[model samples]
Target chain A: MLQTDQLKFAYTGGDTFSFPDISCERGAHWLLLGQSGSGKTTFLHLLGGLLSPKSGAIRLEGTDMAQLSGPALDRFRGRHIGIIFQKAHFVNALTVGENLALAQELAGVPVDNGRIAKLLDRLNVGQKIHRKPDRLSVGEQQRVAIARALVNSPELILADEPTSALDDENCEQVLHLLTEQAASVKATLLIVTHDGRLKDKIPNQIRLDS
Target chain B: MNILQLSWKNLINKPLSMLLSTILFALGVGLVSLIMLLNKQLDQQFARNLEGIDMVIGAKGSPLQLVLSSIYHLDAPTGNINIGEAKAFLRPEHPLINRAIPLSLGDSYRGYRIVGTNHNIIDHYGAEISEGKIWEAPLEVTIGSRVAEREGLKIGDTFYSTHGLDINEDLEHDDAGAFRVVGILQPGGTVIDQLILTAAESIWEVHDHAPAPVGAAPAEEEHDHEAGEEHAEGEEHTEATHAAPATDIPLHERVDKDITAILVNFKARNAMTLNLPRTINENTNLMAANPSYEISKLFDQLGLGEQVLRWLAYIIIGVSFLSIFISLFNSLKDRKYELAIMRTLGASPGKLFLLIIFEGLLLAVLGYILGILLSHVGIEMIGQFVKKADRYGFTGKTFLPGEGWLFLGALFVGLLAAVIPAWQARQTDIHDTLAEG
Candidate 1:
């Protein structure tokens, strides 16, 4: 479960953007709708604890993430949040399997190769585990990214413009995989995007004003 | 998955840059290390030969050349000193002098110097005979260990001496007396090991006369050779000439003899003995040179060139450090995003900092190991040429203790080159970098 109250942020010398409060329970999926410059990505980043809000409480399972800082905050985010970006990026030096193993290690959990293989098999990216990210196809790369994000079975899943680069068929397949994986892990899912195709996919909605 | 593994992967990813940095570092280290090894080995050789003897009394010229020729046998002597003037200190019962060993040079066989000195020289060098007995008369030679092994000279072998201290065929004294090897010295690891020893009277006997009938005498000496026949033959020839055994004639009754030098040791290093070199240099025509002083001055002169080379080696190392800094800095620019992504995946800023440092350290350690190996191999190859040319016995098989400091110095260079890049990695703005994508 996740909740936020009057979250505000500002880039250096830029105008402040105030975000609305939102409460989501376990295993629920939501689409955060916005136009360009609407600060939806900023809101998702705040919820993921990548950026601390200026003045607000972002409570995830009863702890205010805005109060955490430094290594504690980094470890908290790794253990509790899964983030997916529009373009699938990875540490290019590592293979797919190694990237997942790094994610588990950074999250302070013992590396579980069996769980990683099982998750990759479920996402249909099992064959690409030993391949470098650059050698994987776009859709396959996206699936591997999803597997990395969900490897820790985090409590909250955040996707920032997840389907902006994908075609309709691949976009639909990715959205289905994201929701189904979130449900299996019993995590709250929030997808932030300007893409209108995702509006009909999830009923729970939060929209940011430009 | 670990930081070290990730650092290794990143280093090998750009193999060309890594190879360039490593080779540059290795070249600098190898050059510096080779200079040190050569300096140490040459110093050991010089010091070994210079032990015990206080001063060298020879014909006046360059003091360094006198020490080199008389002590090391590595140069031409500064002409010969007359024994009439030098015998003042060469007397066995001289009050100020503990012992004086005469060296009469100018003849060599197979490039090894044939030194004509008495048994006092053998006792001074602690050279024990490994085979046969010491030479008791003229033309009865006792060869050094290295001379014996190199020329295959054994007891009773006869070889003719050359005119100078070289292996020139034109200088062969075919009409002169042939030196019969009466003994072979043990491997004493001193200058004596490279010499062929005989009584100093032999040198005078050989040069004072011309065309002795001993040309055919070597074949007859070899077949019926006994110690008595050789000694009697040598004594009969020396007795016929004015160059008699040095001890038989009293110091005041001696004739003028042409000896090259006298290696003198004082009973005590006091004012009288210390002042002897200045007194001899000023009053007498012979030059008295302190071996240790001349050797140190020689090293100082050679140290100038060594210092310049050492500075050059350090400059090369500094330039290599710069190259390493540039390589690490440039690669960080390309890896900024990857670093930010690592932060987002829960890697702390400290981890990113350590990762960059680890990469730099890996390069340095690799370069250092390669450099040490290259230097020893280079020295071994150079040692072969030096051994063939001057026979100084240079070797690269031993490692110096200072190389441990060099290892630390190399690691310090690695850490120094990595500091800025690692600091930048630690300061990486995760939000901005991730959002730029």
Candidate 2:
């Protein structure tokens, strides 16, 4: 469902990164492993369409991401791709339900409260739907973030070190939930992290050299 | 869910800041609107009563006082003018005068002036009698509609007059005989609506008990005969004799046998009209004043107070704008991470910009509504105070001029205050911001 070829990126007056090419078939789960300063986060951003690649092309469901710019790229990213960042962040002023509804609205799609409630229920966070994101515990907040990423049912899901802040048991449980949710939606999953614990669980892996 | 809803949530999140900005904005707008209401009403009141009469001739004092007293009935008279000396303009055959109405002052009932004038003054105000006949005899008076309504006086009711403009029972002229209410006039919406009308003979008879001047004949029989003839001639002929009969009181007697002032209307605008006031001031013992000119001077004197107040209001508005800018700028700093998250959720930079601007506009709209309500309440309070203190009835429901423009001005201020902050929000780097968090 996703493919990239020699993707490269650089910040202003900063270090440049040339990423190894990778390809994932539909419904495949993979791990991207790298040490510190190895452009793991940079490669995730380029694949998510949050940043334009300096050179090369990222193909998602056959459309080249480099050709999209402005609002068109933004809409494409919102509808076809979802990213779970390392930290759980939300609009603090809104309740969990409103935050989820805001995601649908910003993606320019009709909001389905039933779908949101069902998704949260599957993640075991249905009872906290009315509570603000800050009022929830760390585990509950992580589950809500996962639900937010999966709400659009995008084709490709990218996670950036979502388990780094949790204990081993909670980290294993979170990874199991992520893969199970990805499998249920039939979406390809790619997790970028420095944690070695995830290497044995998902054998399909790509490593970035520093 | 919507942009407006999101903006509302953002504003409510910081209640103290929004409240402070709204209060300051309301105060500034309220003061300006109050001044506009007062200025417009004052102009309307002055302009409505200042019509028809061309010049006021009275004792030599402040020309403004003469206009205020004889035209608006709002102040004490300068002094009295001799009817004999004022007779030239009072005559029907005068070359440049069309109508001259005489006023006899120095008495009031319950703070309303008892203007001792003929029915020509009634014609001058265009008042139609709603109840009874006009006064035909000495001590018979016609009450204006407002005076009758306020004092509960009807035809056939009798009341005693006091010696001056204020209502003090110790200065009551009860011994001068009670004046009967012979008529009640319809409301003219002019200065005449606050007056009690009587023949000038009533004033003479009231003060006739004062010691006579030296070498003056008693003329008691002539006085009685003239009063009876005045009753028979009705009020029409009384108009022509308002000044002439002063000389008829025997010229060798005291010149103090006088009326308060003469209000003159010109037959045509001419060189004589230009020179009339100079002629009166130079040759006669009376001072002539143009009501419009004196009123313009009054506005000029009042303009200083208006300017100072206007500057204060503008400064307050400026401060409100600054406060709004500061509050928004600080809140934008706090929400920078949240805005980046929204961008990650697919909100465009333009949408974020509009969200910030919408918050500012919401505050301004709320402040403007509060300010308008406050000004109306203030106007009602002032109307009550003026009615109680001066017996001048004022309506507080008048819609002020320039308020529509004021609305636009307030919206412009909101837009101006939000521009920089909104631009800052639009330029937020989503990648850098999310990376930090």
Which tens-of-lDDT digit does each residue in B167-286 have in candidate 2?
787766665457889899998878788899998778766555323323222221122333333233323222323333432342213344577788888989899897999988998888
Per-residue C-alpha lDDT of model 1 across residues B358-422, encoded as one tens digit per residue: 98898889988889899999888888886566477877799998888889999999999999999
Q: Model 2 segments beyond 4 Å from truth?
A: B209-256, B390-396
Go through the candidates in order and give each one's C-alpha lDDT: 0.84, 0.83
The TM-score of predicted model 1 comes to 0.91
Candidate 2, residue B75: lDDT: 84
TM-score (chain A only) for the predictions, listed in order: 0.98, 0.98
> Top model by DockQ, which number?
1
Query: What is the lDDT, from 0 to 100, of the residue B72 in candidate 1?
Result: 94
Candidate 1 residue-wise lDDT, A18-47, digit = tens: 999999998899989988888887888889
Which regions of candidate 1 deviate over 4 angstroms? B208-254
By summed lDDT, the worst window of 10 consecutive residues in model 1 chain B runs over B218-227
